[model samples]
Target chain A: MRALVARGLPVDFTWCEGEARARALSEATGAVGRRLDLTDRAALQGFLRAVVDEGAPDVVLHCAAVSQARGLQDLTDDDWDRAVEVNGRSAFALCRALGPAMGARGGGDIVLVGALDRGQTLPLPVHFAATQGMLSAMTMALGKALGPVGVRVNMVALGPLGEGLSRALPASLVEDYRAFSALRRLGTAEEVARVLAWLALENTFMTGRVVTANGGI
Target chain B: MTGRLEGTRCLVTGGSRGLGRELCLAFAREGARVAFTFRRREADAEDTTLRLRALGCEPQCFQGDVADGAHAQAVVGALTRAWGGLDVLVNNAGVQHVVPLALLEEPDWDLMLNTCLKGPYLFSRAALRGMIRARKGTILNVGVFSSERIVEAPAHYAAAKAGLRGLTDALAREVGRHGVRVNMLSPGLLDVGLGRMLMPHRVEEYRAQAALGRTGTAEEVARMAVFLVSDENTFMTGARVTPDGGL
Candidate 1:
């Protein structure tokens, strides 16, 4: 983020989890932050417009979702709807609202973050599967539509990188996962964030695509 | 499993149908958390999801128009929030218009380029941040054989694919030293139903171009996607692998 800000790219570390967190981040980074729900359509539009009004964002780092790990049979309509709208609809709103301005300005970059399982499975993760999959397709489609207008689109397919989920799992379960990895270890959040910065700065020509950052494990 | 893509989280564009679907399944089976996309084809996405679930993967899906920028940003944001970061991104989503050169719709060119080239650019831009922060990542774009030989496909489709190939090289050149690997995969004459639909009559003709006796399969292409995206692919960037059965 400092690197980007140094390069004249406006960096707003958006924090929608809660008001306190958003405020803390805003103060800490001197960047705007938001505390809103992912499912709120109107608010999404307003947030984007606000972003543009402030400085017409060159890139949007999407880092939000509603998720569950239960089986398909356990998922309810609320779960399904929430995931789709939050994961899929919310992203579209950003593009629809902010993309044209970026295009008109001539060559703006917008990268979308896609999850690890749009193509994989995780204990019956049907809801996330649908939402993540569409997110990528949507990115590709927009790549086609926005390319002419001068907006670049891309996606990042992410893997697991934290310790909370691991700590929460049973002892044997961790080993079960470890056995399948090439490095037999978990990844970290910082690692993922580093990759994000490089793509933002260096890989300008590549658009409408995805990048993987899993450790050998 | 302990597959080549073990411990990886890969997102595959256009993953619900044709070669994209196979790439999804193969990634999951290989122990990567695979994320994939489907355009207007929810059933195909569902089918792929159901099968991927059986493989012990944690697959998820997102809905939006890839041709729209707002949606593209949202997708990336959601993934980061949910997974805390991204590992790999595969730009496999694309479209082809069968119209003759004179009959091509203006929007058709946009659609092809958006899905094939522009979308990858979006993902690359967004994912690069996370990858650079981590100091390691992989970017893979799916290319068509027509990228090199443009005359075979429709004008717009071929042109868009050609641009994508160029973008692949450009990305490799720009970010090879950042511990980020970017590459391209070009598959020819896949054996999927869509492959047949894309050119049913030319199946024999397609097979004849490659040294292999028959056309390719989604699984074969998926294998390449896994390699380019796996931990074994640390040093490769802006490289293109033509997985066209020696074509």
Candidate 2:
């Protein structure tokens, strides 16, 4: 979000709005932040309408995710429900609310930032993987639906962040990841932000695709 | 004058003619100290060098087959020695033989795969050494539009191009931590290079099919190529950007 501001792009923040971090970021960036629970479809729709009332943006980025991880054995129905509501359902809700307007405008870009689990050989948290997979499918389907109308739908699949996970992981594990990659490193948030900006702004012909942003994982 | 890639040390493979030639010219115009590979066309390479010089950029020309690992090593070695370190690499050397799979011989298949797939792989391997140390570099691989489909006669060509997607994704993930980016640029039918000769009978049909109702220009593709490797592209890696005028 800060990276986008640095690039001189106008950005609006929309989330459940309780975290001090989100509030501070919004204040620091002078971005309009909305407090809307994505689980409620009507609230999500209303929030988007309010966004349009402020200003119809050239790009609407869906970067929200419930960063909860639980193995399949310990997962319950509620866990699945929470994951679906936060990660999977909200993406579709945004598309349904915003897709038509963007289409009517003759062109717009919708970039969904998804999780790193892309059927990799390694084991993953079942619910997180499921929602991520769902989001990936929806991105492709929406991309095809909106492509002819000039609205581009794309997804950016990211791996562990350099600032977040890299700081927490042990040095040995970090080195393991590096050895796994050809470039041998993790990705920075600025790098991912740059990709989102490019897809939204500079990309001319690319549509209906997943731009993977994992360091060669 | 000052450009986005000013003072950048760059190398482009198979830059004697066609789309590759345009890429070389465009890079030179952007203030990059450019070195390009030519397999056999000495005259074309000389002409390209002269054109770069006209643009006020000192351009180096190397003759080698990128598919041969030794030649790829030599190309990278010479560039590193001349320019100190390589910042950008465009894997554009490619060859195609438009023949049916039934008639495609072992050597022909080898030629297509080796040039299109193995060449990029070998060059990327060599380039990564310096790039890893620098912790900042960009690699662009040139591919055809039919990367995911079988629209042309040469199945081997399509296969080779498709293989690049894997290479791009895998390499991007591995080197991204190092601040290096790798991407594939798949261009659609153009009025230049081998595209002019590819499916000559069906060129008009392909043009008509595009949303723009025309074939793309090499300059158009070159512009996108520059943007992909430029400083402006901060977040794009493991991506295959196709500028086929919406085919």
- Please name the candidate that would achieve the greatest TM-score relative to the true structure: 2
DockQ of candidate 2 is 0.25
Q: Estimate the TM-score of every prediction.
A: 0.53, 0.82
Q: What is the C-alpha RMSD of each candidate to the true structure, in Å?
A: 19.9, 4.1
Query: lDDT winner among the candidates?
Result: 2
iRMS of every model, one decimal? 12.9, 3.7
Pick out the ten consecutive residues of candidate 1 chain B with the lowest summed lDDT: B238-247
Report the TM-score measured on chain A for model 2.
0.87
**What class would a CAPRI assessor give candidate 1's docking?**
incorrect
Q: Flag regions of model 1 displaced more than 4 Å.
A: A1-217
Task: Provide fnat values for all models in the order shown.
Answer: 0.00, 0.35
Q: Give the candidate number with the greatest DockQ.
A: 2
Candidate 2 residue A154 C-alpha distance from true site, Å: 1.0
